[model samples]
Target: MAELQGFVFPRTATGRSSILPAPPWHYSGDLLTIEYRTDPERVIELLPDPIEPADDPGAVALVWADWQSCSDTFDELLDPVRAQYKEVFFVVRGRYQGEHVSRCVYIWVDKDYALVRGHYQGYPKKLGSIHLTRPVAYGKAGPRLEPGGRFGATLAAYDRRLAEARFTITGTADQGGFVNSHAMLHTRFLPAIEGAQAPPSLHELVTMKTVDVDAGPVYVGDADLTLFDVPGEEFGRLAPREMIGAYYRQVGATFVGGTTVHSYDD
Candidate 1:
């Protein structure tokens, strides 16, 4: 018998790094997103130093996505249940290291594996219930202009509704690539182990970016948003000002290794 490499290990016996999956996680999914304006001052207050909210209009994009993700290896694709999951996140157009970028304010997922993997990549992901709905109607008189053809998504946690987004496809354009080109920045933090006196815990705040993005068929539309009073929900702070635009599309991307841009503590 030959030795098997890259096999899963028990987390209790070995730390998360013991069974780390190889790089270039691949994902394909339908994304329904809404761009809206919000108060710039509030948005700025929420951002970390060196990351400023966009000066254009404090634009915030909220997305609800249903995705099937797997490692680069083909064998992993056979397990659909382990690969499928739902996500809802809010991102603000911001400036990072003097460059325009999109920074995630809050994000949630329904899968434990995703939660762990996302956190490792600096995505501030929490466990929650995310429900995404696709438009059932197609062709002319497509979902955009029809009264009941809207795509929607809802986020809830601890039995409390956090937010909801509804969008109707109005048109299609080749600009999907442009709209999805923004680089995403997230913070990664690992606390120091307790009772370790020598080197203090890892308290540094780091930034990570996504690469090799391939966006598919972007549909433009109008959307309406409703935010609820969830105690810990950060999305409630922005308070939608006006609808900028809405979109529905499919995207495939490889989330390879990330580069650390800034460090907060030493």
Candidate 2:
């Protein structure tokens, strides 16, 4: 008799790895974005040295997305739940190594596979309840992607509402803000289990540029944002002082590789 095992991961498992498969992972999704302005000091507090605030440091973008993702290998899409998930992420404007950049400071996803994949790619992803009002075109009841279309989204953790926003579409554009503006920089830190944990087992500042990028017709809108102060959480500190605008769009990309600008293990 022959033994069975996963090809790349879960060396001890008898079958396919419950974790994510090998990349490049493909993603197709609809997203709602809320762009806002906070304060420079708030943005500064989240960043490390050498990666300073941008010219408009307070500019931030929050996104709520519904995604269907698959790896290079899957069971012919027969299992849909394994490929569906929702995520909300927060991004801020910054300059990395003298170039304008966007850095993801916080992200919350609803699936373990998505979280684990993000960790490997340097995104600080955690689990949360993310609810987005997806537009439906079947009947004339739910929101539609036409003029005056209204949609809302929320993020909650520890049974507390952390963020909220509403958007009403007015027109169309060709692009999105920080979420699609530049190469996203991330801090990949895997702390050591023993000793002061000063030097992590792996500490890196990596950049992400997904291939096969496609931006759908962007719907522009006016937006309102409200952030709540949750106990033991600092998400409220970056509260929006002014609403920039709102947008809804469909975006597609493939994640394969990341470039590390700095490695702190030395």
Candidate 3:
């Protein structure tokens, strides 16, 4: 007979801490993205100073992803459900410091654990329901299988449809030369404690950070996007002029650290 050890773990307001685990967090999964051209004026209105919309057709990309993520501290291999979840994000292409970059405008996830983890990394993630449909085969099995298939996903918040997208898979290709941009930028704000006389004149601060990813094999495809009536005005502005392209791919990244590009006091 095996004996179990009884131990108590520290807890916070949210739950157990998943941050102190360690480095080299591994995330492997499929990402289906739909790209759309938008008004350059609207894109400019959304970007902060030192960031400008890309010269090539100002575009926004929506991504639907299902991942199996783990870290050195918590090998999800032991319990897959603990680390597996679905996510969706709306991003815009922009330029920073003379380099093309992508900035996340909004993001949603189905799990609280993922929400906490993303927030710590400066990703503006919010709690929502995301459903990503797996790729389905179209024809016969084996070598006779059709060259293309289909993928789809939907995102909802507050019991309302935020957005939904469908993609027609064409074939697989190298991760390079794809419309999917790898560089990302986000802003983080630390506000001064209100009515704290002891702290005196401590200033509120805001900072911008960028994250770059090296993607793996990419699946090329065509996509269609449907934007629904959401609470935010920004969501309405994202209505696609036209879908430029779409692609699917498996991704892996080691989130190390970020550089603070800008800071402002309240």
Q: Write down the lDDT of every candidate, Cα atoms only.
A: 0.73, 0.83, 0.67
Provide the global lDDT of candidate 1 against the true structure: 0.73
Q: Estimate each model's TM-score.
A: 0.82, 0.92, 0.78
Model 2: residues with Cα > 4 Å off, grouped in runs: 1-9, 13-15, 74-76
Arrange candidates, best TM-score first.
2, 1, 3
How do the residues 1-266 of candidate 1 rate in per-residue lDDT, one tens digit apiece?
A: 54445423433333433334666788888888787778887678767876776666367778888998887775457977778899988887677767777777788999987887877777889999999874444665334433335776798988998888777667787764222247767777665576555354544445544467788767887788899977766677788887778878878777777777777755
Candidate 1 residue 53 C-alpha distance from true site, Å: 3.6
Encode model 2's per-residue lDDT on 1-266: one tens digit a residue.
55646534454346566476767888999999888888879988998766888988888888899998988675525688889899998888788878988888889999888898889887889899998888898986668888899888999987988888888889897766664478888888877888564667888888875899887888998888888887877767788898787899988899887788888755
| Model 3: CA > 4 A from native | 1-22, 136-146, 175-180, 195-216
- Point out where model 1 deviates above 4 Å: 1-20, 135-148, 176-180, 194-200, 203-212
Instruction: Output the number of the TM-score-best candidate.
Output: 2
lDDT of 3 by residue, 74-180 (tens): 66768877778999987876777787777777789988767766765657788888887665445443121124666668999888898888776677766523334
Q: Residue 25's C-alpha lDDT in candidate 3?
A: 65
